[model samples]
Target: MSVPQAKSPPKAFDADSAQRALRLARETLQIEANALIALDQRLADGDHSIVQAVQLLLNCHGRVVVSGIGKSGHIARKIAATLASTGTPALFVHPAEAAHGDLGMITAHDVFIAISNSGEASELMSIGPIIKRMGAKLIAMTGNADSSLGELADVHLNTRVDKEACPLNLAPTASTTAALAMGDALAVAVLDARGFREEDFARSHPGGALGRRLLTHVRDVMRSGADIPAVSADTSLSAALEEITKKGMAMTAIVDVDGRVLGVFTDGDLRRLIEHVQDFTKLSIADVMHANPRTIEPQRLAVDAVAMMEEFRINQLLVADADGILVGALHIHDLTRAKVI
Candidate 1:
């Protein structure tokens, strides 16, 4: 038997190789960025297709049906999700599966957004006729405007790119980026047309921090009832200090006989008093308190409370009812712990 040749050793990693690798990666990013710039210029040059597609989606009475194959399918799913979260009802359906049985998901009042780089995906092409036959509007996102799927579409969005970021120019790099950008553009336009607000977005994302900040009311996250730190305005300074320590709040509310808040005494005020007064025992809580303190209503949003605290540079806020009676209290730490900050 002939002797096998010795296998060569693996090349050692060095600074030169690392530099070349980094340069290539940077070049790839720059090329993709340039593609986006070109797409932006094209849009600024008055590409009416994007606007027309947004109008079609806005006019859709039923849900939006987004369909694609392969990498385009992944991008299509993302587009569908974004549209759904931003107030537009949308879902992704695989074109191949649509041909199998998912076509039933499409309705006459729905709008179809089909994505394919070449505008010639056989799976999408197969469902194109069915979508049209069902009286659904078809919007095609493709690089080739003259391709079959483009010809069948009511609106053709041009997502063409001069080159792929891939060195071999075989992968869907720049094309997919352009397609995703176009989808985002359409979603934002429709969102603006429908006047979708942040509160509307928060409703769909109720489990998120933003939702908590927008939806949670001051009454929901406040220390109320016995937890409120308060003392009689005539209470001695020593007794007011005991109330603050017992209630575990840095401040205490001074209330009158009818339980209406007269003033507030805080740690900062205590510090200032110590600096100015020689005998703390002789002072009444009312004498050292800050009158007309900033207060928040129980019905306001927690985020508004945070804004108030930030604007007034106070760490705690007194929650009062319409009658100016102290109902609850909260600190910055409470908002931070609740993820409202």
Candidate 2:
């Protein structure tokens, strides 16, 4: 039997090959970035195609039905998601699926966004007549303005790219980037036109950190009732320290008999007092407290409280009611724990 030689494991690795690979990747990225810049210039030159597309979707009483094939289909799916998340109701309907039975999803009141790089995708072209017959308005996003799908559209958005980033010019690279950028532009314009606020976005995304920042009120995360570290102005320094220690907060609030906040005594004050006063135990909390400390209302958003804390260079704030009565308290750690920061 001839001795079989294991073909020397194909050059396990090559430093030169790795460097070439990185260079190619960087070049491709630069090309795609340049394509986006070109698209931006086209839009800035008074191209009303993007604005028209937004108006079409805005005026539609029904959902935005996005359809495309192949790579364009992938871009259509992403655009649909962006539109839906940002307040416009949208969903993707694959062109091939529409040819079968998904066409039932389209209605006269709906607005159709058909994406095709060449404006000649067979599946999209096949549905063009049926979409028109249904009386739905068709908006075409394509590189070829005179192609079949473009001719069939009520409005056309030209997503033409000067060149593809692919070395062979056969892959969808720059064109796809331009389409994505156009989709983003459409979504943002509609978002602004509809007056979509951060709170509205938070309502749609209640499980995310942004939702917590926009939706959580100061009272929701503040320590209230007995958990608040509070002491009377006449309270001895030792007793105030006990209140802070028992409450597990680094500070204590000095309040009047009516529960109105007079000032705050914090760990920083304790440190300063230790450095200056030889008999801290004999002093009252009023002597060591900082008067008119930063405060927020219970109804204020937690994110606003975080801003106040940052602006005032403090870690905690007292939550006061309309009458300036201390109802609760919050620390920077509270916002951190709530993921509002």
Candidate 3:
């Protein structure tokens, strides 16, 4: 009885397959990590020109205009978004389009952030004279500090990488990643310097999940008036059960004569009551209701409600006002529908 049965045959391992996957993943991650480290090294120790450039953007009453071409253009767009969301006003303007009419997007009070690998992109160079003539500060992000764009800038942010991550060594993989990281560093530095809070960021990202969770309150998603499943405490169990069934909610609130919540009864209660008590019509809902149920304040943020629901592992909650009178009810589904979860 103590003898152990032979272990099942060990799963086969293809060394070639495992090594190929691991090699690719490690190589890619190593390239990106190295590029980021190099970018970090280029940042000045303290309040320097690049730091001052970010400060300038933060202080500008106008917007930050970001421009680049090709892969750098894509990175510039993301950087602009990061800046805008983190409290610095910013928008992306394609270098080519700027030659037509997008240049109007850039005003004298705005700051210009231009990206180029060699610091000699033709499109960026074409708009250079105009940007300078407008008296807008030009902040350059490039690998070549001596190139035309760099020389024309008010501040230079070096995003140089020794080599490209692509096997051909001609693609802009490492350089773009470094540039993006450097851009992020600048935006976040400005954000921290300005003491930008989460609520501020949430305001900028109102359509996103974190924004909804932070800004949406219980009243924004609660079932109100006719939508709420509720009945008076003196109501018979059958009537209360009918209310819950008609509203399609798992539970119904039991209220007193003054419309104040007294208790709650759920599907679980119905099941238990049915098993032990058969006189549903004769029984009063108050006798079997759960008193002092968990509730949330109407003004509480949706994120707080999510936390409470997770902690209690419940799907619904009652919302009360400052006076503890029932205002509304909320279900977990409501949060998901509002994209607040």
Tens-place lDDT per residue, model 1, 195-287, is 999999999999998899889999988999899999998899999999988988899999898888889999888888888898888889988
Instruction: Choose 2 or 3, whichever is better by TM-score.
Output: 2
Ten-residue segment with the worst summed lDDT in candidate 2?
5-14
Assess every candidate by TM-score.
Answer: 0.93, 0.89, 0.84
Winner by lDDT between candidate 2 and candidate 1? 1
Given candidate 1, what's the lDDT at residue 295?
91
Candidate with best lDDT: 1
Give candidate 3's TM-score: 0.84
Using TM-score as the measure, name the better of candidate 1 and candidate 3: 1
Q: Model 3: per-residue lDDT, tens digit, 148-224?
A: 99999989888888888787889899999988988888888899988999889889888887788789999999998
Cα lDDT of candidate 1 equals 0.92
Better of 1 and 2 by TM-score: 1
